[model samples]
Target chain A: NAGVTQTPKFRILKIGQSMTLQCTQDMNHNYMYWYRQDPGMGLKLIYYSVGAGITDKGEVPNGYNVSRSTTEDFPLRLELAAPSQTSVYFCASSSLAVYFTDTQYFGPGTRLTVL
Target chain B: GESVGLHLPTLSVQEGDNSIINCAYSNSASDYFIWYKQESGKGPQFIIDIRSNMDKRQGQRVTVLLNKTVKHLSLQIAATQPGDSAVYFCAEGPIDHGSSNTGKLIFGQGTTLQVKP
Candidate 1:
């Protein structure tokens, strides 16, 4: 089902540069999320959307922004990129039926290096 | 803030041996837990999950045990295989304070498991 797919497997951005990481899911999931994983660290939530037209900040959303204009797409935008934003970005989606313990399916991930 | 942490940063075991990965969570309110395995250069994959209502749950060759009293969770992999070599992360999902099930997951630092044949 290509469950979830992300673009630009890897990227390197210069300081102050801006870029968008694209994510798409065909599972018809209502929930989508963006997370960043640092070396030797767990993933930190960047942003998430409950459904189309709904978006909210997560644990580490300072350098990023997101929008959910459609149910199948959730893109993360990094503005004025900094070195601190260098990390592996992952996109995940899950259904709301099993809301109590929804199992999140993740994409391959986008490796970003801000220099 | 609430956090989930692993007991060990790395674990090495024989291919045929069983492996147990431990995790400790600070939030007593957390009711749902999950274990994920991430291979090199790949995103994390779901391995198993357990709810606060059940102390133990078993999957194919893996089992998850949750101890709410001590706020501890463990994942046991039987006959660990080379394919099992990866970073294991434990995530906790606290009960949704709001109306909807946002499914906010708090992940642990992760444990790198090495299976030697």
Candidate 2:
């Protein structure tokens, strides 16, 4: 079973460009999250969805949006991409709330570079 | 503002030796703690976790120790190996069963583990 999968493994975006980073999970987890890992930094939460049709912003969500229409997919949209947005994005899924201290399985991540 | 931080930025150990990584948290109300390991070009993988209710938890060859009184957390690897070389992160969050809670995790700057053969 492919636990968590992310598309567009690598991408380069010009300034002001837009793109969607796709994520999918075969585990059917109710909890999905989008996190960005900057160079030499821990993962920072950008957005999260507890279940289908529900989404919320996390620590750094200024330039990103997320939609969770189905339990298997959660895509992160980058609008007017900037160099600050250039970072590896990782998608994760878990059965229980991370606030409950549940383990999260992560995707292979998408390397994004904005110039 | 909640924050998690590691005591050491890098830890080098000889193969077959034991390794210990230390972390601290600023949130007293944080009830959950977790450790993740990331390789060169991969996502962070769940290594182990602990709750405020427990002092220690073990899995395979790894152990997580939580000290709520001092807001300290540690990850112990029984035997270091080349494959164990990676960046390790400690994350903290509070207990929130509410639907509105987004389950945010405050992560620390990771500690790079370098294992020597």
Candidate 3:
């Protein structure tokens, strides 16, 4: 099973341009998350979904939006790309029934550059 | 705001030696801690995790130790190899204050480990 997969492994966008980062998981996880990692730093959550039709903002969700219309797909939208949004974005999924610890599985990652 | 921080930004070790990476968290209420390893151009991968109830957990060639008294967590890699060279991050997750068990994770600044042969 391809635990999780992301589309457009790399992309470059101009300021004000908008695009969506696509993510899908075959594991049928109940939780999905979007995170961005800057150079030499750990990742920070942008948004997350508990299930389809339920989404919540995370630590740094100012410039990003997300939707989980189906259990298999959770896409992140960048409405007005800026230089601050240039970073490696990751998609992860996990099961909530694992009790206190939930091991999140991550996709390869999408590297975005905004100029 | 409460945050997690690493003790070192970079560490270099000779191949076949043991390596230890440390992290200090400000939140004493955090009940779950995790370790992730990321290669040069890849996403972070789960390495190991320990809950507040346990002090130590071992996996393959790695071990995680948690000291609640000082709110410290550490990852130990045994007989480190070239493939073990990567940036390691420690994450803390607190229990959901509400009815649900879902919660967000806070990641610490990564610590890069280099293995020299």
Best by TM-score: 1
Model 1 segments more than 4 A misplaced: none
Docking class of 2: medium
| iRMSD values, candidates in order | 2.0, 2.4, 2.3
TM-score of chain A of 2: 0.96
Residue lDDT tens for model 2, B1-117: 678999999999999999999999999988889999999988888898898999999998999999888999999999888999999999987778665555667889999999999
User: Across residues A1-115, which tens digit of lDDT does each residue of candidate 1 receive?
Assistant: 7899999999999999999999999999999999999999999999999899999989999989999999999999999999999999999998865436588999999999999
**Residue range B5-108, candidate 3, lDDT tens digits:** 99999999999999999999999989899999999888889999998999999999999999999999999999999999999999999856544666578899
Residues A23-64 of candidate 2: C-alpha lDDT, one tens digit per residue: 999998988999999899888999999899999888899999
Position B113, candidate 3: lDDT: 99
* lDDT winner: 1
Best by DockQ: 1
The runs of at least 3 residues in candidate 3 whose Cα sits more than 4 Å from the true structure, single-residue gaps closed, are none
CAPRI category for model 1: medium
Whole-model lDDT values for every prediction: 0.94, 0.92, 0.92
TM-score of 2: 0.96
Better of 1 and 2 by lDDT: 1
